[model samples]
Target: MGALSVDELVGRDEWDSVVRQHRRPFVVYKFAATLDGRIAAEDGTSQWITSAESRAEVHLLRAGCDATVVGSGTQQADNPNLTVRGNDDPRLDLAIVHNPDRQPLRVVIDSNAKTPADANVCNDAAPTLVVVAEGADASHLNGVVDVLKVKRADRGLDLPAVLTGLHARGVRAVFLEGGPTLAGSFIAQGLVDRVVNYVAPALLGSGKSGLGDAGIRSMSGILRLELVDVARSGADVRLVARTVRSR
Candidate 1:
C-alpha cells in the first residue's frame, strides 16, 4: 500500500486506525524466552534476552499496530517506554513504517491501578491508557495518563471488555507484549490471534516460563499454532505463528 499509493497524501481527520475490518482489533502477541521456555531468572532479571538485531525487529511490528499492550507486571518490572523508538533513535525502523509520529498507544493492564505517575510508559512520547477494575484507584493517575475502568474479573479486569472498549475507540490492531501471566489469560480465553516467540540460545533451568497456565486441564485443551515464518535474528531464533482457532 505504500509503494503504489497512500503516501504523504493520506491524512486523518480523527484517530481512526483501521488497517483491516473486524469487530475488534487484530491481536498479535510477542515474547522472548530461553531455550527451556523461561522468560526471566528466579531473581526477575530479564534484560537482553534477545540480541540487538532481534530487539530492533520488534520496533517495526509496534509501528503497524494501533495499540501496544503490557500487563502491570511488565510495567513494574521493565518500565518500558513502549514507543516505536525511532523518535528516540532515528536509526531505528519506526521511521520506515509510517509517519514516525504515528506510534501505537501504550496500554497497561493494571487491574488495581498500580501504575505510578512517573512511569516511563506515561512519558510524552505516546498516548497511554491504564486499564483497571471498575472501582480502582485510578484517581492518582488522572492528569498523567488516561485511565480505563472495566468490569472486574475474579482475579483481574475483564479481558474481553478491554478489547471491546479499544475497538470502539478506533483501534484495529493490538500488539500484546506479555508478562507470561497476562499472556496466559489472553490465550486461555482465545483472544490472541498470532504469537511471535523469540527463543534465545541460552537456558534457565527454572524461572518465569514464557507463558503461564493457559487453562489446559488435559492434552485436548492444548492450544496449537501453525508456524508461518522462522528466521535468525542475531543469535536468537524468531518464530512467527498463527493460532489454529479451534472454536
Candidate 2:
C-alpha cells in the first residue's frame, strides 16, 4: 500500500516468525549481475555493472549493517574498500575471509598460512578480525593486521561460530558482498537471510555466473524467494526478493 520499510522489503518480520529465530546474527546479501546471470565479463572485469544510484543504494544497505564481508577472490578481483561511503552516516566494519595478519581483518578459512603480506586490507586504516582454524600453518605475517586464530574441527571456517562471535562483538547485522563461492557457502549453510539483485541489461555468456556451482544440486535446491518489489533504474532492473526462510 504505502512505501515499504527496508525491513518489510527484506522480510525481517518473517525471519522473526521462524521457530528457530536467528538470534546470533542476521545476514543481507547484495550483488550485481547481467540479465543473463553473468557477474563478470569474459576477462573477469566487472565495473559499473550497476548504476551510481544503485551503488549508493548498496551503500545505504551497508549503512544499516554493522559489518560488511567479502571473500579473498572478491578481494583480489574487486579490491573493494568494503565500507559504506557517500551517505549521511556512511561506514561499516569490514570482514574479509583471508589471513588477517597477512591482510586486514582478513579471515583465512584454510588451515594454512598462504596469504601475502601486501594485501590492501592490511594497508587500510580499518579494524580487522583475522580468523584462522586450529593447526593452521603458524608462519606469521609481519603485523599488518590483527590476528585471531580460531579452532574449527571441520577444518574450515566455522561460519556459524564466526557469526556468533561477531554478534558477541555487537554486529547485529552482517552484509555479505562476496563472490559466488562464499555466497554459495552461506546459502548452502542456510545462513543467508535475504538477497538484493541488481540486474543490468547485458550478457556475458562465458564468464562467472552470479551464483556459480556453490552447491545447488538442482533447481529445487536453489534458494526460493518471494519477489517483493521491482523498480527500474535507468536501463537496469533492481529486483528485491525475500528468502523463503524469512517468509
Candidate 3:
C-alpha cells in the first residue's frame, strides 16, 4: 500500500463497531505533558508544553474526529476555540464550500454552566454544545450556544448518558481534551478507548499532574494500556496507546 489513509490509521472499522456496540461515540483522550508527567507549572501555566509541530498534530486529530470535548476547568484555563486547523487540502476546501458545517462540533462539559459567554469555545466559528447538570441555570448561555442537560454524577455530569446523547446526534468519534480531573474520571469509569499523549523533554518539579485521582488503589488496580504507536514530533515524543481490556 502506498500509505494508510487517515481513516485507516484511525481504525474507522473499530470505531464503528464501538459505536454500534455501546450506542455511544468512540472516545479518544489526547493531552500533552512534561517529562515528569506534569500538565502545567506550579502556578498552573501550561502554554507551549510541546513544540508547534506537536500542537499542529493535535489539530489533525481534531479534524478526524466528529466532536471535540473539554471540561469547564479546561475552558476556564485555556479558553481554546477547539476548532481544527493546519489542514489545507483541496478536497477539504471543496467539502467546506459545499457544507459549511464541516468542522467538528465543540462540546463543553460544564456541570454548573460556568462557561463564559465570551470564552473562545463559545465562538461562532463552529457549533458548540455545552453539557450541564440537570436543574443547573443555563440562562447565561442561552443565546451564546446550545446547551444539553444531563443527570449529574458524583464526579460531574453523567458521562455515559452524555456519550449516548452525542451518539444520537451522530457523533461517531469524540476527541477528549479536558484537564486531568475530567480525564481521570473517564479512565476510572473505563470509558476511554484510546489515549494519545505528547511528552515534552522539559520537567516541572512541582506542578499539576497529567492525571488526577484515577482510583487506582494498588498495583493491581492500575489500568493497563497497550502501546500501539510511538513517534517523534519536533522535540516532543508522541505515544499512542489503547486501553487493554480486563480479563
Candidate 4:
C-alpha cells in the first residue's frame, strides 16, 4: 500500500461538509499520550509529551476543523488558546500552513461556569463559546464570553445537546481536545466519530490515563476502532482511527 500524505490522515471517508449536513458536528477526540497510555505525569505536567514534529501536525489537524473543544478540567488546567496557530517546528514533509487565516472557534464545556474570565481561552485570539447547564449561573461570564446552555445529564451536560448547539452555530467539525475525563465521557456516549492519538516513544509508569472511566467493565462491550491512517511524526507514531459503527 502506498503511504498517505500527512494532510490525508484524518479518520473519515466523507468530506466534513457532507457529514455536517447530517446530524450534529463531526467530532474527533484527539490526544497525545506516552507509550503506556499516560496523558500526563502525576504532577499534571503534560507539556511536550510528543516530539516537535508531532505538535506541528496537531496544528494542521485543528485547522481542518471548525471548532476546538475541551472540558472544564482541561480549561482550568491548560487554559489553552484553541486557535489553529501554526507551530514553530518545521514540518518534516514540507513546511506549510494549511489555513493560516483560519481560526477555529474555541469551545469550553464548562457545565458549572468554572472557566475564569481571565483564562487564556477567553482572550480575543479566537471566538470562545462556553457551554453551561440550562440553569447554571453564567451571568458573570455574560459580557466576558459567549455562553450556550444545554440540558444536564447524570454526569455532566448532555453531550449530544452540546453538539447540536455547536451545529447551529455553523461548526461543521470539532477537534475534541482533552484531559482524559472528558475524552472518556465522549467515548462512553459514543459521540466521538474519530480518535486521533499520538503515542510518544517514552513511557510513564503511573500517571493520568489517556481515557477516564469509559463505561467499559467487560471485554464484550468494548468499543472497537477501524484504523484509517498511521504515520510517523518525529519520534511519535500518530494513529487516526474511526469508531466502527457496526458491532
Top-TM-score structure, candidate number: 3
Candidate 3: what lDDT?
0.83
Which residue pairs show backbone clashes in model 1? none
Model 3 TM-score relative to the real fold:
0.92
RMSD of each: 5.5, 5.6, 2.7, 3.4
- Candidate 4: the clashing residue pairs are none
In candidate 3, what are the lDDT values of residues 1-247, reduced to their tens digit? 1222236445877788888888888888888999999899999888989998778667767777889999999999888988876545332334532343888899999999999889998887788999999999999889889999999998898999899889989999999998899999998888898889899999989999999887789998889898877888778898878888611
Which is better, 1 or 3, measured by lDDT?
3
Tell me how far candidate 4 lies from the true structure as C-alpha RMSD in angstroms.
3.4
- Model 4, residue 23: C-alpha shift (Å): 1.5
Which pairs clash in the backbone of model 3? none
Per-residue C-alpha lDDT of model 2 across residues 106-208, encoded as one tens digit per residue: 3333334444566655556455555556666545654665555665634246788777777666666677777787788777778787788889888777788
Q: Please write out the lDDT profile of model 1 over residues 66-176, one tens digit for every residue.
A: 899999999999899898854454544544434435668889999988899999989787889899998778888989988889998765779889998898878877889
How well does candidate 1 score on lDDT at residue 219?
Answer: 85
Model 2 regions more than 4 Å off? 1-20, 87-117, 137-143, 151-156
**Candidate 1 ranges with C-alpha deviation above 4 Å:** 1-22, 87-101
lDDT of each: 0.77, 0.63, 0.83, 0.80
Count steric clashes of candidate 1. Answer: 0
